[model samples]
Target: MGYGELIIRSYDPQYDRTRVEDFERKCEVGPAKRVFLFTDTLGDPICRIRNSPIYKMLVAELGNQLVGVIQGSIKLVTVHKPPNDLAKVGYILGLRVSSLYRRRGIGSSLVIKLEEWFIANDVDYAYMATEKDNKASVKLFVDRLSYVKFQTPTILVNPVSHRMSRISSNVELAKLKVEEAEAIYRKFMSSTEFFPIDIGNILRNKLSLGTWAAYPRGESWSGVPSSWAMLSVWNSGELFKLRLGNAPLSCLMYTKSSRLIEKLVPCVKLPCIPDFFRPFGFYFIYGVYREGPLSGKLVRTLCRFVHNMASKSKDCKVIVTEVGGSDTSRLHIPHWKSLSCPEDLWCIKALKNEKKNSLHELTKTPPTRALFVDPREV
Candidate 1:
């Protein structure tokens, strides 16, 4: 079926809000599995990248009908060097095409146009993420777009429960001031690939709940902890809501049964799961870092603390985070295997050449497992 001429143009919220939201509804994203995922942008299509320093939203229109949408954001990030050793990188996200427009080149056209914008802005590199099993995305970005395979991070999700986990009596957890958190991150995480240079802005943003640190009860330091771990929480729920689709019947039955039992007997927790079948919100754990002995244990304690805090919010259903595939810290975080994605694929491309003999040529080297996932990108 031939659709009329396709025109790619910048998205204007004033006139495109409803059509964009409608287009988004038809583009529930995920691999074709018994369990997939959907996102509701909560009225604004660009909510995800709204707070970014440089961002753009483009829409593909066929005969005045919006058929595709793509969002991109540019930021200065560390490429594993000194604090001043930063590169301008563009992130492509929320790429979507209408079901009726599939295979008609709308998706690819939108991406090409966005890349042109990135090039015009002097972006050094461009990257994007998708599910590891998404063959279509792989074909589009890798096979067609010539983007190279980059980092593979695992997304960990632990649902908040009525039951709160008790932290070890020997551990002490405290909230850090925004300045303290920024100092710690710059001192330690500057070497992490893609660590944001404007991390202080992220921590001080309204959406950030705060940063937390955990350590042995008796041990402490003036500016940093000797044996400790720290993480920051971003209220991702504020940007969008998620709903699980085509979930397995066994899982659904368990969820319903557990909730029913809990209603019948309030005292019996029954491990009742939240109703993910409907739209729900979640907290994203970012800026995850640790050091010293038993730091893995400290990471686990920090996750439990976040889970307990999330439980207090009626809308927060899960605590989620992403870490490098080889990071041992994953072993310490509490998350359900079924609810977590073990391999989230990231693809990268160099739009401009790096300095001669520069070790900062990000596309040429494999990522160190110590990755700093930008919460804004999530």
Candidate 2:
């Protein structure tokens, strides 16, 4: 595709939906032979980014076909500085190019156009996340686009079992009212990197199932627990379906035998892996904030609580969450090593260096608080 023939414009849902979906189907994500991942936007290509305060989707057209698409959203987020030091940060995601038009600069053109929009909006910085092993993506962003590798977060995935995992009786879990949740988050997470300033809106969003806190039993209800953990669940499955492809024979057998054993013996407590070969939805755990000396236990209990809740849902096959590689809470969150990825790369670029914190300073600074993974970006 020639640069002159390619036209980049804002996506129009009326005529672009079907074409976008078609292009998505033709494009394969993830590594060959290891995993083939499919992301179903459930008919709305923009559903994932629509929840952000400011979002836009753009499409690249070569003649009559939608060959490429990219989405970007801007939000006021806390940076690696003093508490409440907020900056206009833009997030880039859902970049796709048609398989037939590879290496012809469609992907690059789409991203360049999106970054232009981010700069025009006065975005201080922009970042994106992708699998560390995605060489093409790494080259496009890190080498070609001048983005720096900032953070390597792990995607923690725990399969929702048929049987519920038990939480310790010593831990007391309570659902926090919207106001209560908002107040707690504002107090504790304001210093965390990428912490949204409009967290009140996130907690109150309809997709936010709710927020819950877990602490030791017999703690005073009025006061904060000495050792406690809090998290909010977002109904991401409602917006997209993730399908696992290229399953190995061993995995297939394990899933089958586990199901058969469960059917034959009702009392058996086998860890049954759900049928992931088909399309399935998932719950995203965000705002994984904890404090106190015994917060690890509280984090595990909260994870089990979310697991039990997911077991009741027909479509929810797995519980997924991401935390920084250095985040200590990763030691407590329950996840299968085989299913979870150890590193998801985040590449960032400074749109402008007029601010007090330069791009180099931001990259060199060590994270002081746990990363607050914004659910809207998930």
Candidate 1 local distance difference test against the native: 0.88
Tens digits of per-residue lDDT for model 2 on 1-378? 253599999999999998887777666667546668788888998998999999999999878877889999999988876364778999999998887788988898999899899999999999999999889999999989899988899899999986878889999999999999988887887877778989999999999999999999999657867888999999899888888777788888999999999999969887788999888999999989899999999999999999999999999999999998899899999999988889999989988867435778888888655888999998
True-vs-predicted CA distance for residue 29, candidate 2, Å? 3.1
C-alpha local distance difference test of each model: 0.88, 0.88
TM-score of each: 0.95, 0.95
Q: List the candidate 2 regions with Cα displacement exceeding 4 Å.
A: 1-4, 82-84, 266-269, 355-357
In candidate 2, residue 96 scores what lDDT? 88
Question: RMSD to native for every prediction?
Answer: 2.0, 1.8
**TM value for model 1:** 0.95
Tell me the tens digit of each residue's lDDT in model 1 across 1-378: 666899999999899999998888767788767776788999999999998999999999888888899999999987745566778889999999888778988888999999999999998788999998999999999999978777899999898887888889988999999999999899888888888889988999999999999998877656556689999999999999989888889999999899888878888757767999899999999988889887999999999999899989989999999999888889999998878899999998878665323433555576675678988898
